[model samples]
Target: MNNWELLEIRESLLRDLAEFIEDNYYGTPAPHEYRRHELDVRLGKKLKFSSSYPQMTIRQRRASDLLLQVGLCGATEYALGTIEDEDQLKHGRERLVKMKGDLADLMRDYDNCLSEEERKLLLRQAKNNSNREESLKDSERDSLLKLVIGMAVGAYCYNPAALKNDAVSDITKDLEELGISISDDTVRKYLIQAAAKFPQARKA
Candidate 1:
């Protein structure tokens, strides 16, 4: 019920609503629901975890997609993917400059009114916007995307032509031996998604 706790709760509820909206509105129905169900099941497991963070992240008592002008910049950062190299970075900076300026302008209305804690939060946020943090975000995003895509790749190897069932199992075994934390089910889901994207299968 403290301000910090309240803020975290609000953010979590907003995220869940956003997830629902994206699945219901933007994503394909059957597949999207499948993903949503998967998320829910994973979340159900998380409920038994003895952590406040998990509770704060999902299954809230109320929905709260009522954020103001400051939208999902973090999620946007997630979805926009990432730009590699200084040249791409510089171009992105140029494009974001105008938007950042606009944000600063909006913040001015509450400038003198901001709490000390809020001000420090803003300062850290500014530091985080520097390339180092952006790179960190990109690295994190890449890890998750790779998991999604890699799972698909592992799934494809499940039924490779000329390979016996035991041999195919060994192929997935090799992938695990290589140190990737993926499940056979995740791999199967990824393969289906990959197939949906390509017009025709290409020899690898």
Candidate 2:
């Protein structure tokens, strides 16, 4: 009914959506459709809960329930393994490169439009925003590359004694082509970590 109550419910819904995405996407094995069915059932239970947030009006309840349903579908599609993981990696890498180029152009345009004093202030703000963007992009890039490394390591771990050395070259070359600054040694380290993690999962 009140703004705070609405805001609180929205935040809770967002956290729930994110949890559904992460748990279903990475934690569950295929076929993901089964996990999606389970998610819908769990979401139904959550919606029935009468929390401290003032009782939602009929319109508000309908909107919130619809949002949950739509969010689940969108998350499922985003995390869907319809394509090979390698293909998804290439797509994500390309998107980041395009985003960087777009940001560069935007900064240039913004700089051209400002007065000298305003430019200085805006530049400071831009730099701060840029740092935040870089941090987030770095994190996302690391996650995607880890998946790449996992694929290679999974193959090697399939039969460790017969492991081929070219896995490093494979991942390193792809990363370099995508403008990732990591070294071959770093890639090797990531592969080693993946190897360790995969076996532990298998044992469990």
Candidate 3:
């Protein structure tokens, strides 16, 4: 099966298993560690954190947990999907959309922060201050960057593979779906550069 399909199958099984544990094992005169271990084994993803963002802390296992809490509280109509009650999918979609909006907002800020004159000045400064800015700009890829900026953004936002594979997949996937058209590899390379800058900034 494809990765997404495999994910869905695994998710369905894990969901059923978790529910079984919660209902039958929790406070049911039975040990719970085995159930927890089974669930953990089912969820084989190991968490790798990034010091750069230092912002996103996923408290729940998945969006479903948050959706379940909302259901318990009668928070919104969203918790009721077509399947009687399980708005987790809806919540996941909303969460994805919200993340996309956030990335767009950030990109807008980046654009607003840098005026044409400032860009020229910065490019000039970079050329003067850096060791190989000119040579780097002379590359074929450098020329393509001017043509590919929007494509890059679209691709970055759409391809979750580029970001989620790292610590910042949420933004990356949302961005990919948001119509950014750059390649996933480009996004990863840039994100890595940004992460590299983070450690250097702290040192400075």
Which structure among the candidates has the greatest TM-score? Answer: 2
Error of 2 at 57 (Å): 2.9
lDDT of 3 at 121: 57
Q: Name the better of 2 and 3 by TM-score.
A: 2
**lDDT (Cα, tens digit) per residue for candidate 1, span 62-106:** 232122222332222222224546676676666556554554454
What are the per-residue Cα lDDT tens digits for candidate 3 across 143-179? 4543333343344332322313332334445555665
Model 2, span 90-196: residue lDDT tens: 78656555644543453344334445875455445556655654575656756765575556646533222222355565655556567654434445555555555
Off by over 4 Å in 1: 1-68, 72-96, 121-149, 152-203
Alpha-carbon TM-score of each model against the true structure: 0.25, 0.25, 0.19
The residue-level lDDT of candidate 2 at 135 comes to 75
Weakest ten-residue segment in model 3 by summed lDDT: 73-82
Top lDDT prediction, candidate number: 2
Q: Which stretches of candidate 3 lie over 4 Å from their true place?
A: 1-165, 200-204
For candidate 2, what is the lDDT? 0.46
